[model samples]
Target: MQKIRAVVFDAYGTLFDVYSVTARAEQLFPGKGEALALLWRERQIDYTRIRSMAAPDGAYYKPFWALTVDALRYAAERLQLLLDPALEAQLLKEYACLSAFPENLGALKRLRAAGLPLGILSNGNPQMLDISVKSAGMHGLFDHVLSVDAVRMYKTAPEAYALGPKAFGVPAGEILFVSSNGWDACGATWYGYTTFWINRAGHPAERLDVSPSGTGHDMNDLLEFVRTQGAAV
Candidate 1:
């Protein structure tokens, strides 16, 4: 609303398709691949949330890489799947190169063309974000990649969201925080950002008082929102 000077995105579900790991997973686990991916992701977020809430004083912190591996192992145990060391290594390797969404590049280019500083504020560690960004061929698109590891916290925590404003040198209201996760969108909004929710899966909104400034089905819609807003300014 204050004329967005920066567009900070959530990396995993928003830019990179976390589900892309399903290819190798399917090969490893056959018909159970989809289930494994879903459960693994669920556990990953659950672990982060638990850690963040359990230590409000920032006493407990684990890098997302560790949490991701732990989530995969837990998911395998829950599903009664055999995840040998070799198979586990392969799965983690595939995850590091998660594919970007089909429209991600074009939309990002459009935003860049509009002269908005683009950044990423994510739970991913620096190395993980670096690998994923390069692998997706989005090497130079971002002006900043702010990882929660810097603050030893996770999203939905105000400190994690504060990284964006700090990185971009802008107020939260001047940053358009875009996330595919409804809870993330809500969190960003509550953190004072003009948020966008990319509801790619058509999921229901989180039961939070905060609502996104805009909602879209994909990056294409995000591009249009940026374009329209840019024109209006």
Candidate 2:
């Protein structure tokens, strides 16, 4: 494989704990926070995929923030919970400030010290990415915070993956694409980037024919992978 020249990350689950909204969720719904969070996330991703597959030409594109709201509503209905406008607004507000993984800031700093250009390529819309990163106190760590809104397509779409190479001015083979989502890793791999999957939950890998170049449990493992790839970290 080519020497890893830059590292690009998937933001939502990989850097920010999307489930961190559970605290506010539980406060709002009383007893269904965990269930609500899980279902909301699942539906958020499902909506992205459905939109992308339904219109590969960008005709059906919607901002991730909108999809997230729709997912929350769907999840609430599925769980028989009452999500009125105020509760719905509260959850979305919480989501805008999702917490970062405990180890992420340190690991990212180490990689930055190693002189690798780091970036984020997320399905999130630009405003959502900006707010979340700033709220998490990771305001300036990355060289780019890319959003799929540019191409009106989400992850698993080659256009979305292309942003990393374009922004970093590197070939796909020379960039390490990191994502917590197995399907995203597979998509990046298929798009020719060296990929790493952060399997924090120890979930099974996707059944897709492709696989990530490396798999680990956290940002620390991701740092190790970069070190092993001969980066100065």
Model 1: per-residue Cα lDDT at residue 138: 94
lDDT of 2 by residue, 1-233 (tens): 57999999999889999776988898888889988998998999999999999998989999999999999999999999999998898999999988899999999999999999999999999999999999988999999999999999998899999999999999999999999989999999999999999999999999998889999999999989998999888
Clashing pairs in 1: none
Against the true structure, candidate 1 has what lDDT?
A: 0.91
lDDT of each: 0.91, 0.93
- Model 2 scores a TM of 0.96
lDDT of 1 by residue, 148-225 (tens): 999899999999999999988999998999999999999999999988999999998888877898999998888777
Cα distance off (Å), candidate 1, residue 50:
0.7
